[model samples]
Target: MILDKEVQRKLKIEPIEGSYNSYAVQEREKKDWRGNIYLACVAAILAISFFT
Candidate 1:
């Protein structure tokens, strides 16, 4: 699974050959942790505006 591939990468383990490109370094670069943190902050702001 792609999750395993990503986890392995984060843990510095080598993934098996012939896996899909979902976790390729180039593609994952755009969707890194910083991007996720930004998205989370945006979502929190939207939720706050909606509720209060």
Candidate 2:
């Protein structure tokens, strides 16, 4: 699974063989940033809903 691949890559217990490692790194970082943005949007929506 890609999740396992990502976790293994970050933990560095075993190095990934090749291109898969770079792809995992990109995916992880992208998701991390996206999560921050998503949370901010959700919080804003909730706050606006509350105010209305």
Candidate 3:
């Protein structure tokens, strides 16, 4: 498959290794409490909708 020039350019460019690692670590350390609550609400809604 052929890639676009822009995509090729982006793929060839490398981010700073240390900064990339730290950014990934920071992202992993962050929590999404609202997302968890939203998922729980959706699960509860589905359970009630189907089980009742």
Candidate 4:
């Protein structure tokens, strides 16, 4: 499920018809600032574990 942005851009890739638009994705995360903070905490833990 890896959408390689570099390859896609170079190849002029386009999404399928009737797909969920980018706006929908933005709206879904619009009110999820708290979730983002939690993710940042988890990422910090993982980074610390890796570096330490």
Candidate 5:
């Protein structure tokens, strides 16, 4: 599935609720980081497939 760049951009602009507490934010950030890494890896794999 293709991702819309604008949608991702808009999501980034919004403030997350319940993320102010240190522990909550830390856990949330870890999840977000993991998601970002996974998405990036998927994109990279797709790009590689197109070239090969």
Candidate 6:
């Protein structure tokens, strides 16, 4: 099946070789402590807002 130019342009194409590097980056992002803190703060704010 042939894909339209617009559809092809919008599609995200990644190389198989880059998949490993992308996985490593994702792993590093998962280990970010600052993200955890930010999430906790947001949760606390939401909880407080709901309660009060």
Per-residue alpha-carbon lDDT of candidate 6 for residues 1-52, written as tens digits (9 for 90 to 100) = 7666543223344445645645222111225598889999999999999999
Query: Where is model 1 more than 4 Å wrong at Cα?
Result: 1-31
Residue 49 alpha-carbon offset, candidate 4, angstroms:
0.5
**Candidate 2 ranges with C-alpha deviation above 4 Å:** 1-31
What lDDT does each candidate get?
A: 0.64, 0.63, 0.62, 0.63, 0.61, 0.63
Root-mean-square deviation of every model = 12.0, 10.2, 9.7, 13.0, 12.3, 11.1
**1-52 in candidate 3: lDDT tens per residue?**
7665543221233355756443222222336599899999999999999998
* Model 5 lDDT, full chain set: 0.61
Question: Candidate 1, which ten residues in sequence have the lowest lDDT sum?
Answer: 21-30
Compared with the true structure, what per-residue lDDT tens digits does model 1 show for residues 1-52? 4665544233334455688643423222335598889999999999999999
User: Which of the predicted structures, 3 or 4, would earn the higher TM-score when compared with the native?
Assistant: 3
Model 4, total clashes: 0
| Candidate 6 wrong stretches, greater than 4 Å | 1-30
Worst 10 residues of 4 by lDDT: 21-30
Residue 8 Cα positional deviation in candidate 5, in Å, after optimal superposition:
29
Those runs of model 5 whose alpha carbons end farther than 4 Å from true positions after fitting are: 1-31
lDDT of 2 by residue, 9-36 (tens): 3332444577455432332332458788
* Cα displacement (Å) at residue 16, model 1: 11
C-alpha RMSD between model 3 and the true structure: 9.7
Q: Mark the 10 consecutive residues where model 5 has the least summed lDDT.
A: 22-31
Off by over 4 Å in 3: 1-30
Global local distance difference test of model 2? 0.63
